[model samples]
Target: MCSSSSSRTIPAALAIFLALLLHWSSAQLSPSFYDMTCPGLSDIVLDVVLQAQISDPRMPASLIRLHFHDCFVDGCDASVLLDNSDTIVSEKDAVPNAKSARGFDVIDAIKSAVEEACLGVVSCADILALAAEAALGRRDSTTANMSGANNLPGPVDTLAVLQSKFAAVGLDDTDLVTLSGKEP
Candidate 1:
């Protein structure tokens, strides 16, 4: 009799324990709750991160792949969000000091904002992908609006010509878009 009663009580106790643990750990939670559409906070942060890395060449290609995987596999569920787990972000390391740049600064600003709001909630992997996508989009849009190849980075402009302008903005053509999250 005692064994039977304890077995039934154990399940109930375990359920309550799990519920409380989930609640306590979720104190900070996130801006966008997980759902089918998009992970709101994660998406926004990733966008900012991709924008940040547009001009950075040192970033690894594998990191870029992970960004898309996170977004596409789960529609920005924030699961792809890897912590890169580094307490210290190396954003300041790769940039050159003398050059005049606009986009890198924007990227930095975005990173800062996310840190303020979500900090550990996001991962370096997601941030990198986000920054890349934003940079790519900006460059693409600029080219589309251009009149000709000879003009200021118009779509018709040669690939090399566009790169020069991208340097000014701290971005490149290849840095944009992830395979999955663009639509979601």
Candidate 2:
């Protein structure tokens, strides 16, 4: 459940609009065009592309959607340890590992590796926070190289595609709506 190109790489204004839209929505409505503008396109898009490297061919958008929906629901909390953390929402009881979220989990690992290489030079948030900024930039580059397209997908489409795709997966309509996360 990945996003389409038309709605990828959303502007900042769109992201806020989309968030507000989510606030008012009822069922798993198509993320309103306004609320579809997600701010983390670069990272999300990159994730979809990378995931496509797998052979399953179940649509990258769907897989990505499931991950994002989960992350956003819990405010992208990296501490969502299945058996460890107490705050994880029990809806489907998400499993913690390299599969569902490569976000804060990998962000933490990268910070650790970078620290071992450079030592206490990076704050956890700085290392983890810029992940989206740095990732979106790279996503922009990848799209540029592919067909000289400016960006692969817009922010809204990125999220919507994920929703559509993941719905086909086990992630349900209810889980997405209830999503909460510590904002990055």
Best model number under TM-score? 2
Model 1 local distance difference test score: 0.35
Alpha-carbon TM-score of each model against the true structure: 0.24, 0.28
| lDDT against the true structure, each candidate | 0.35, 0.34
lDDT of 1 by residue, 7-114 (tens): 575345444333322322333333233222334555665565455456543232333333323322222222333222244222112122112112434434655776
Each model's total of backbone clashes:
8, 27
List, residue by residue over 17-97, the lDDT tens digit for candidate 2.
Answer: 345334433353331211234333334434534454353333333333333433333222222222323532332233322
Off by over 4 Å in 1: 1-38, 42-102, 134-184
Could you say which candidate leads in lDDT?
A: 1
Candidate 1 residue pairs that clash: 46-130, 49-131, 50-130, 50-131, 50-132, 51-131, 143-155, 146-154
- Error in Å for residue 42 of model 1: 4.8
Compared with the true structure, model 1 gives a TM-score of 0.24
